[model samples]
Target: MKYKWKPVLAAMLASFCLFSSPLTALATDNTVSTIEDEMVHNTEGAAEAGSAETQTGESETPVQADEEPGWPSGPSIVAESGIVMEVSTGTILYSKNMHAQYYPASITKIMTALLAMENCELDEQVTVPHEAVYMEDKGSHIALDEGEVLSVEDCLYGMMLASANDAAYALAIHIGGTIEKFAEMMNERARELGCEDSNFVNPHGLPDERHVSSAYDMALITREALKHEIFRTVSKTVYYEIQPTDKQPDLIPMSNHHKMICSGKYHYDGVFAGKTGYTVVAKNTLVTCAARNDMELICVTMKTEGRQVYVDTATLFDFCFDNFKKVDIGSSGTEGEEIEVSVKEGDSPEKTEKIPFRISEDGYVVLPSQAEFSDLKPLLLLNADRGPEVTGAVLEYLLGTRTVGQAVIALPESMIVKPEPETVQNETESEPEQEKEKEGKGFRWWYIPLGILGALAAAGAGFLIVRRQIWKYRWRKNRKRRRSGRH
Candidate 1:
């Protein structure tokens, strides 16, 4: 069934870049350092497509390769963990080791960006803190001097585009008054977004064992963050120049670390924004967006082998866009069969029946060929003579073994019986002959009086009938006398 979502996508992909060798390997490659050069080289073609298509030969890269080629032959590709998701539906197309824990590294900035947009006004000016500037021990840095003041918007670009640890810390401190407090907010937001295996130690996603999240959790976080218009815009930006502040005379050039933004091969037609991360441990992690024929998809890859992560994620996207389709899987407006139900204690014993109805429309569900229809369970809330009265009965519809939608079945209100005095009496045992004699005394005394009244009424009615007959006869006799007199 086609469900119209209220502008919401699930939190499905996110990553972090800690400075660990394993984690750093994914981010330090040619993709990260040469982003500016690539963007300039492909700016002409990319501009025509409005940032949807990346540079040449890099569009819609899949997260991981399948066990065998030619088709999506296996479960969603995975090195350490990965996910292929439909962007518009937030439905996971493929996943492997998606729930496995890995450092989110810079991908943690996705949450930072989300929290900043939610908590702080974009116009709010923040003073860069000494602590934010001094996180040199952590790998990523924007090199913001202490006491520099910048707007929340500029810091956002720095955090998202440059993967700046300083910008993340500064934004965290500005919004929450402390990095620890901001970290708490991130964790709380993660939990609220249903990131079951995610935790946060720092806003910048530096190397801290405490800062860990699974691919599934990362996807969940990404899905949640992408709903915000601000986050979507910021994450996709290839380059932005932060205006000069009072202390800083030069404009800081912020650039997107994700190559999919500039690579022509994997650039989708509709991908607005996404995030990327790397650490030696997390290894070449990427979360990307793509659009085709108005359908958008998000793919995540972590711990992938060499350059294939991009290719795998792209393949997953193509498979999803090409195979399954969105369809309205709901019932028709007109009522279907009116099922007859028995009602007890009806006025007419033979007419103890009520009608309930089910309505369905023609539509199909979008799923892989291997998918099957889930069992349909009748949600009948019929009013029986038992417990509490079942007032509103309905049958919810199911899709793929889940209650994706519901259809209401109206029960006849008048069909329900209220317990009468005789019904209550039937439940109690009757007394024996002595009690019967006691009952007979009061009934016997009133019976004669009631019988006399009934006889009087009947006699009165008989007299009225005789009087009417006599009146008619008198009228006919008068008419005869008048005729004789006239003769």
Candidate 2:
């Protein structure tokens, strides 16, 4: 009975294994499939995320390239309008909304000083007007009073160094007769200096909706002002001692308001001249000039908040000095050898002569430090009356579409060869004689023989006629004799 029960139990266990094995295997396969689906979904999501990141990374490639070695990514500046210009070449190195107009504040005195240097003698006396001294209630001034006398030079120092509104007004009134007239003169001079978007409503740059200038226009005005020796001298003055005026008995010591020029904290090694301007409306406007290794740069920053103006200007100067260099495109004393041009309709159409042209002046071009001469393209623009003797600008060197420098196309005074006038021989006189000679030569040798033969034939015909006449006569004579004999 025990052996029968053991066999029955073994048979029951075998049946249970047979029935559950397939179900268990199916459940395990379902679990693996669900996990694979989850893994596939996660992999697809990760790939999609990676693809988006790659697209974003590609857009930022240029900025990354600018940060690479030897490549300069310009410093971030907070100024609303700024420009860095090369003084010698007038090449703008960096710009941010440079043409947008903003209030000039005290930087207007750069033009004021320039006009004073141009129109009046430095030692000439300027009588301060009451309106000029009292024009601005809340602005920088040197405490000038009515009928106070100061030289043009002293007023320029006062205006530029101290950002004195009164000094600027007095100088303007002296030069232009009235403030409105001076404003007109300022606009005219600004146009002459290539400032297109500048308007001066007041000489002191007091806040007015009409009185505004762009960073680019102010840079142009500053560049022109720097050309004047007196302006340069007065602008760089850190401290100037003004002699006691009739209105102010105490000696008024004026110091430049520009930190880069006066204070040591923001001062730079090569900073030579600068002007500072500020108002509640026009915040922290600054114009500065610096020189390093003979390369001069002018930096103008406008609408900057707080002390960032000086930092922005100094950063611009560093960028220019680091990345750019002045290349001498042409030298003044070195004249280009004469270029030969063929004269088409002159005395000798086949003749070619040389035109000796010199470079107009020593022309410099500001370019990247790594730039080469091969990057420059020379375009020769011949004059409408272009000839060996015509003198003017012959060719211009260009970097892309910009004209970098020019060469004077002129005939040398000593080497100018006037073309000889061609003699006009009379065609009527010479042509007929040539035609007669040609006609004589055109007669053939056979024509001469034919003419002789025709003459001989005519003579032979005459002889025949004479013989016939004789024969008739003889025959008549014979007939008469015969008749007589018959009778």
lDDT of each: 0.64, 0.73
Off by over 4 Å in 2: 1-73, 136-138, 331-360, 380-390, 403-487
Provide C-alpha RMSD values for all models, in order: 25.4, 31.3
- lDDT tens readout by residue for model 2, 14-63: 99999999999998665433221011112335434533432334422311
- In model 2, what are the clashing residue pairs, if there are any? none
TM value for model 2: 0.64
User: Tens-digit lDDT track for model 1 on 233-350?
Assistant: 8877888998887898888887676656765665555566777665545545667777765455667766553344556666667777776554333433225455443332324342
Error of 2 at 442 (Å): 64
TM-score against truth, every candidate: 0.59, 0.64
User: For model 1, what is the error of residue 13's alpha carbon versus the real structure, in angstroms, after optimal superposition?
Assistant: 52
TM-score of 1: 0.59
Worst 10 residues of 2 by lDDT: 33-42
How far residue 167's Cα lies from its native spot in candidate 2, in Å, is 0.8
